[model samples]
Target: MRKAIIITLVVLISSFVMAQKPLFKVDTLSIELSDLSLHAVLTKPSNIDNPPVALIIAGSGPTDLNGNQPMMQNNSLKYLSDALVENQIATLRFDKRGIGKSVYPAFSEADLTIDRYAKDVRSIIEYLKEKQFANIYVIGHSEGSLIGLIALQDISVEGFVSVAGAGNSADVILKKQLKPKLSAEYFESVEIILDSLKNGHVVKNVPPQLNALFRASVQPYLISWFKYNPAELIKKINAPVLVVQGTKDIQVDDEEAQLLAGACNNCSLAEIENMNHILKTIEGGMQENIQSYSKPSLEINKVLVDTITAFIKNYSK
Candidate 1:
């Protein structure tokens, strides 16, 4: 009876201790921008008192806080947040204005400039600052890298990470992406449209097939996006920067990472092998790589995460 009582007491005590241990928590947050409200997901370690925090900016074109677009759903950013929490770090990932929960009908499409995106990030960084997070970092994936770099100009942070960001200007990147798929004549038309937009003029003669990418509605935004070169902007950042690229990424290549690393005086580069644009490890052709965009089940490349973790930890030290 005494032995059994002792065992029961131990089990109860163990259960109590386990219950006392806190798990990571998530909170749905919002920041107001004039008439619109930007939606965000804040993830943090439950036991951490003043954990280092990262502002995770998603890529372009309607990517949500979880890094999903309308046609595809993937938890790339969500997985990244969880990984950060596992390392006792806090993170805030948000939807860009006019994307996901931030899409308000009252907002004009013309307001979608890279500057606006940078301002939104700055707003969040200011909020985290108010919350007393001593160490703040920014991680931008794809187009978010450009936005984050721009944001760094206005708001200071400990470090910045660019994942699969294009080093060239938007016009140059677009031309490269269209070269293989477009006919010679159609390619000329693309050049004309891009040139007009580069000169701050909108063209109404958009080809039917190209309307989705270079439509009149998006021209103003494109004009704004075209003015900034990622390489040039990255050179202006004073904070430590990490340029991360995947070897198998179909959207971006190693050259972009190299260019970015070369531009920044304080920068480190990490190229993950077999990792695609969505940060998944896929050792296959283009079809298999593209298919990974919607596969949320696959985790981000561990090397990518480890590289970021080590970079931040070392910088903090």
Candidate 2:
């Protein structure tokens, strides 16, 4: 009986050790914004003397803090947060106003502008400040990068990290990315739709054939997004910036990274080979690249993590 008890205790202790434990505990907070209650996830470091914090902003679509879209169920940001926490970095990630557990009163794409997201970011920054956080960083992905740039105009962040961020306007990016995948005839049609948007025309009746190409939910956000150029914004930012891009990213190309790098007075770009838009290493063709988005088994490259950690640590000093 004593042997059995010893064996059970050993197993219990081993289980505790083997279990995946978060380096930090995630705290959820609700902040009142206009007529909505915004929800944010604050990951507090386990052992630190009030370490600097970072606010993580998700990309386009209905992406949550965990980097999971409604259609794409894999949670990449969860792993990212875990990785960051392992490095003793506290992070805050949140859902957009109308998504996930966040409050929504029929919020539409028209209401989703860079300004609105900036406002939300400002609110979160204020909340962090109230918590006595001395230094705050902003890490933005894709569309969130634009929002982060806009947020800088209002809030004072210690530093900024742009992950897979575009250096051009949304319209330019859309045309460049989508045109190659579609037929030349269909591509011209897309240009016409974009031209209409550029002229500030509300598209009420998209042709039935273009339904997949032009989503109603994406239109208004696109309209609001068309007003800003990321390169221009990058130039105006006074804080030290890190531009992390993947060479294999199909959405935002190297040219975009170059444009951003050229515009920034105090910015450095780290290009990760074989890494895709979602920060997963892609080894195959187009289909394989898209498949990586849903594959959580694919881990973010170690070099990328090391680079970021080293950069942050060196810059923090």
Candidate 3:
């Protein structure tokens, strides 16, 4: 009986030790940006000598640092951050202004223009500069790419990575995405809506059918967003750029990726076959493609990681 008790205690102690093991230690910080407190998570390597850090900017909408969409329950960013930590890379991710632990008077989506977002990035960069990291790189995904690009005008980052970024204006991309999703009869109506926005016209009382496309709060944002072309912006960026596009990405096609690459004087493009917009490998039909978004078991393509790791490793040295 004494031997049995001892064995049980040993197992419990071992379990406790394993549970206490640190996979990674992340620091949660509140940064003051534009008179508001922006929440950021900074994860560092366990042991390193002046390691380079990557700042991860989440995509459009109310995406948190963990890459979770407010409307959805996906946690893709968390997985990506964990993977990066395992690779001995440090990362910083944060919530956008007025979203998730961020203080705001609730700015309308219309007020959430790219310039405003860029200001937020600038604030974060300034904060990072104080930390004295060896190198600072911005890794922007989707709409965040535009924010990062605009921020570059103010902050001096070592390099940038655009993941599934759009090459054209948001208006043009929205129109293209809506055409196939909407019926032929509704195409003209959608075009009219986009035209009104392009002309900087305030559209009140949007049509019931168009509510999904244009929210009352997001109208002004769409108006501001439609003005900038990513490809043009990419051309203006003097820093080394890396564009990663998944071949199976339905939201942004390979053509857009190519356009971004072509615009940048110093840029490298990595096309990951069968990888979806979220970086998961998808097989079968369109339904199957989206299903990967919910599957946490689905890992991002190793090629994507290898490409990014190699680029950062070469550049950091």
Report the lDDT tens digits of candidate 3 across residue range 1-317.
99999999999999999878776778999888656889899998775656778889999877888877656545667767777777777889999897888747756655677788888898899888898886888999889898898888656888899999998888888888989988887887888889889888867868898897777777878888888888988887767899999989999999889988888889999999888888777777799887876676777777777777776777884
**Which residue pairs show collisions in model 3?**
110-221
C-alpha RMSD in Å of predicted model 1 compared with the true structure = 1.7
TM-score of each prediction? 0.95, 0.89, 0.90
Residue-level error in angstroms, candidate 3, position 42: 0.3
**Candidate 1: C-alpha lDDT:** 0.87
Per-residue lDDT of candidate 1, residues 1-317 (tens digit): 99999999999999999998877888998887766788988888998688888899999888899989888987998888888888888889998888888888887886578888888889889999998889999999999999998888867899999999989888988888888998999899999999889888889878898898887778888998888889998888878999999999888878888988888788888889998888888978888888888888988888888888888777763
| lDDT score, candidate 2, position 7 | 100
TM-score, prediction 2: 0.89
Best by TM-score: 1
Higher-TM-score candidate of 1 and 3: 1
| Model 1 quality (TM-score) | 0.95
Candidates' C-alpha lDDT: 0.87, 0.82, 0.83
Measured with C-alpha atoms, the lDDT of residue 219 in candidate 1 is 87
